[model samples]
Target: MKKKELIMIGLMIFSLFFGAGNLIFPPIIGKEAGTNMPITMIFFAVTAIIFPVLGIIAVAKSNGLKNLAGRVDSVFAIVFTVATYLAIGPALAMPRAGTVPFEIAIAPYLPEGSSVKTALFIYTTIFFGVVYWLSLNPNKLLDRISKITSPVFLILIFMLFLGTFIKPMGNYAQPSEIYSKNLGLQGFLDGYLTLDALAALNYGLVVVFVIKSKNIIEEGKITKTVITTGIFAGMMLFIVYMMLAHVGASSASMFPHTKNGAEILANTVRYSYGDFGGILLASIFTIACLNIGVGLTTSLSQYFNLLIKKVPYKIWATIWVIWSYILANMGLNKIMEYSVPVLLAIYPASLVLIMLALLDKWIKGNTIIYKAAVYPTVAVSIISTLDKIGISVPLLTVLAKKLPLHNADLGWISVTVVSFIVSFCIVHFSEENK
Candidate 1:
């Protein structure tokens, strides 16, 4: 590809990675982090920026999403890829695509006694139905709409940030309960829960599909091009995330103490631009969310169309919209809570695959080593996730409860350590056997 074409591709990839959830988290972290916004932003950037960039690079380096996970094992490749896509699509991304519109746009307008349940049901159905319809035929409209929305989203956010800078909110209050100590770490972890990095992994597949369809790079060179493009895309993501976090921190005093991240973001936008600002922000979020839904649905439909052979694209898209609409009606807060354990179960396994894929040249696609690394990793991740949701794993729970960390999310830390140890042992034993 020409240099100019590559740059445009990189920008498009970057825009694809940024979504409505990405817009919501920073401000929530900022509000709670209060006096420690800087620390929090740094920590948040680790998962929000660095991990996601690494995921994209992993996909690129491995030549495609299938190759990235397939290196682990054929069964694992299928299971992991399918699970991740579903988690990011119907279970998380699609429903969220609908929810953000309501939380940011519709929620504030409702009367005290009015039925939020009814409104959510209607809005989500229409929002995802439109997504289903548009995604059924993937074309230039997808790109054009996203191109328009991404900039508008960025501009609305910039205006909100400008308001915060020009006329600051009240002085930062003391850090909230969790953020009071080690504000940076707490804020960073909180930001990680926004799951943008996970989204990037799924979105990178779409970017790769686009690149291939355009025939911009030869088959052999796709891997190198994807990595290079991903770096540029990742840098853009980092810049956008940092800016949003800063904006959120700056506007902390303007919002009430709300537990919901979406609520905090909506309130901040309303404070910055008043009713007009609210409408503008809502429009931006709605467009951004819709694009995300379409992209996710299209990606999944394509994958299944390939995998199942008999499933038509339109059939898969329709099924996704109906299922996602049902999931969306459960409400955002509940959906998020339900997703945590699933994320915990999947994230470590995904991370391990990403790490191994990036280092594949060194590892030489060793199946024994991959199995050794993955099995224990999955076992520990399952235990850790169960621990997180207050479900006891008996032996694992007993051991985890004694750990010296907040709520034992440190379980992930343990899982990583154990995965390495197991992989090393397997490699050593296998070499001796050979």
Candidate 2:
């Protein structure tokens, strides 16, 4: 591919993955991680940047996630694929994307006495309508996202970041207990919560299509190009995240303690530019969010068409638009409350799947490895999800708390490692004996 073509492709990948909710993470991490920001961000990058890139590489090398996942079992493949798509689609992400622009970016700018509920309904209708329209044709997603939405979103975000440099907010403050005590691990856990790796698998499919649209016919070449583009996308994420985190770190001394990255960003912007900052920030969020909504609607609709073959793509997109619009009207907080538990339940399994896909050559795609690693991780994640939603199992909660790195919400990691080792031993020994 030409340089210009590669840049456009990279931007498309970046936009597909960088949803507006992503804006809410880095700053909160910086705020808490404080003086230890470098170490924290390095760990954050390992999960957020590195693994997500690897996920794309895996999908590209395997030609698709379904084929890779099928190494576990066809039944598991179908179920996991559908669950992953839906979790990132209308069920959670789309609704959250529909609402987030307003909650984090736009709502602050609304005139007093305006009906927030009424405004949300109006906004999401247009948002999902555009999403549905864009998604109606998958071939054009790269054009709309990369050529139009991505550049606009990048410019607006860069404007916000630029102000932080032109005028510093304040010095980074001392970290809170968890961040100070367990900085790298906490940051590692924070990165996992981004859910980008799962999204990367889905977006990897889009990359394949985009490359084909350019007439790169060979699978190996497509895979190689995708890996290169993935690194480019990861670099973009690192730069953007580092800037956003720096903004948060700088604001810690000036602004009072804020609970989320969005609040931290808003306060910093308002301080720098007063009333007009709200408008600028709102545009950044609105564009970023709308890009993701369109990308998800397109990816999911196409997948459903392939999976079922009965329901058409447009129909699926319509269903998503309707569902997302309604759920979005329920507002951002409710959407996150429902979505977080589902993501918490699924994300560990996703990471395991990605890691295993990377190691498939070494293990020769052993079903035993996939089974051992993912099954227990899924179970632990489900219990963790239940605990998160306050439906606790007393003994399980105690066990989870005692696990290595559990304090960082990685209770499943220890269990997954042990399960994989034992399963590998059993599988290897049995084969040798036979």
Candidate 3:
């Protein structure tokens, strides 16, 4: 491929990875981090930026979607592949795509006395209906809309940031309880919950499919192109995240303390550019989210078509649209709450699997060594999920409570350590047996 084309592909990949959560997360971190915003930004960027870039590189290096997860085991590969795709598709992404439009766009136009829930219900139904129709023919039109909307989203965010610098929103407030003690560490941990790294693995497959269709790269060159594109994409994410964090930090005094991230974002934009700015930000987010909905619906339909030969793409697309609309109508808060536990269960395992995929040559895929590495990874992931949902897994919770960092999020870190140690032992045992 020519240098110019590769550069364009890199930009496209970057935009694809930058979605709703990408826009919301950094600002929340900044607001909570208060005076220590810079340290928080750096920490947030590790998982939000660095890990996602690594995921994209891993996908590019692994050859294809199947190969990426196949390193662990065939059963694991299928489960991981399907679960990851679903997480990014209808299960989470689609409903989010629908909700953002309602919360950001439609809510602003309604009368002060109107019901937000009722408006959300009507808006999401229409939104997903359009999403379904457009997804019926997943062509260049979806690409065109995304290309147009992505830049608009960036521009609106830039305006918000620019507003922060031009006119201050009072001085920064005191740090929140979580941020007061271990600002950087908390910021880093929060970044993991954004789940963009998990999204990157899925988006990488789309990137590979697009590249192959264009004949820009052969099988041998796929890895190099993916890695290059991911690096370029990561750079873009870092810049955008920094800008948003700056906006959040600077405008800390404008918004009162709010438990929900969405409210904080809404208040931030309103403070920066007034009501007009808030409306504009909402419009951009809504449109960008709509494009995401189209992309996800199209992808899910194609996946189901492959899995069930008799089920047509159009039929599945319709089903996805209807289901997503129902979920979206349930409201963003509900969707987010339901999704957290599931994401907690899947993300750690997915991260471990992606890392294993990238190191496939050294590990030797699907051997006893690989299964051993995988077992501990799975064990740790289960513990992580249990902790995330506030569930006390009797044995693990007892063990965790006994540890030094037990009170904090450090229990998950301990699980991670045990996973690595167990993996090492497996590799050692396999070598000795050989």
Candidate 4:
């Protein structure tokens, strides 16, 4: 591909990764981080950008998530890959994307006594209709998304960032309680919660296929293209995150007690642009969410088609769009509330899998090592997630909480590391015996 095409592909990746949570996270982080914004954003980029970039590279290197997880075992490959797809697809992220714009941008303006559910139904029907159409033609994603939708989305975001500087909100407040101490770790943990890492593993196939369609057929060239595009996407995310975080920090004093990023943004935009600001913010959300909807639908459909060859891609797209549409209308907030525990359980395993994939060469791609690292990570995370949701295995939950970094929701990291070391040593001693 030419330089311009590469840039456009990068923008497509950006649009795919940039969604409702992406919009919501930075502002709250900025509100709390305040004076610590610089250090905080750097660490935030570690999980948010670096890990996700690595995930794309890892998946691309392994051909796909299933192949990467297959280093553990075939059963694990199928199970983990499917779970990751569903969690990031229609089950959670896709539905949330379909409804968030309606909640934040459209719902507030509904006529008094209007039926919110009815309005959501009409809006989502239109939303998913567009998503399904675009997703059915994944080959044209480059033209539709990278060339058109993504550029428009970027312009609107730039408008919001420019407004913040043209008319400043207020000075950043002192760091909030949670952010005052362990700022870097807090930033990493918060960024980790974005779920972009898992999305990267799934979206890597999308990026790879898009590049291959351009007739870049060599594996080495494909890997390099994907990595370059991944890094470019990460850079865009960093720039956008800084802009949003600045908006959040500058508005801290102005919008005191604002509970979430959506509220902060709505208040900031309205203050800066008045009634028209609502329209602008709404436009931003609609485009952002729509971009995500199409991206997820396309990627998920493509994967399902690959997994089950008898089913065509268009049929898979139709299935996901309908499923997501049904789920999107069943109360957006309820979907979000129920999704938390499931995502928490899967996230650590995703991270560990990515790490192992990246280190595959050095580790000699040992299945024992992969099993040691991944199994404990999932076990610890699931126990912890269950405990949080009040469904604890009493003994395991207690032991999990006592592990290092448990309070930070990262107890699994320590457990995975210990498991990996023991397994590596066992492999080495067996080799010595041989």
Clashes of each: 0, 0, 0, 0
TM-score of each model, paired residue for residue: 0.87, 0.94, 0.87, 0.97
lDDT of 2 at 384: 77
Q: What is the Cα-based TM-score of model 2?
A: 0.94
Higher-lDDT candidate of 2 and 4: 4
Clashes of 1: 0
- Tell me the whole-model lDDT of each prediction, alpha carbons only: 0.72, 0.83, 0.71, 0.90
Tens-digit lDDT string for candidate 2 (318-433): 88888888887865577667777887888888889888888777778889888889988988888877877888887987777688876567889899999988988888888899
Please tell me which model should have the higher TM-score, number 1 or number 4: 4
lDDT tens readout by residue for model 4, 190-232: 8998999999988888888899999998989998998888889
Specify the poorest-scoring 10-residue window by lDDT in model 2.
330-339
Candidate 3 segments exceeding 4 Å error: 112-118, 133-142, 171-177, 256-260, 331-335, 387-394, 400-434
Estimate, for each residue in 1-434, the C-alpha lDDT of model 3 and write its tens digit.
77766766776666666667777777777777778888877888888878887887777677555576776678887887788778777778889888875665567768999998888887787778777766777545325544565567668767777777677777766778988898878878878877877877776656776567567576668877777777877787788888877666656777766555566667776766677866767775776676677766665676567668799989998888988888777665777676667776677666776677766777656455556655655665567567767777878767656655545434445555565567767777878999
Question: Which residue pairs clash within candidate 2?
Answer: none
Query: Per lDDT, what order, best first?
Result: 4, 2, 1, 3
TM-score of 3: 0.87
Off by over 4 Å in 1: 111-118, 139-142, 171-180, 217-220, 254-260, 330-337, 402-408, 425-434
lDDT per residue for candidate 1 within 1-434, as digits (tens), equals 77755666676666666678777777677777777777777787777777777777677666556777776668887888888888888887788888877876888788899898898888787788778777777655335544565567667767766777666677766678888767766755775676766666676666667677667567557766777777777777667766666666665666656665676666666776777766777776787787788778877887788789797978998888888888888766777777767877887676677777766775778876677677766776777677667788878767755644527354555655665667767787888899
Model number with the top TM-score? 4
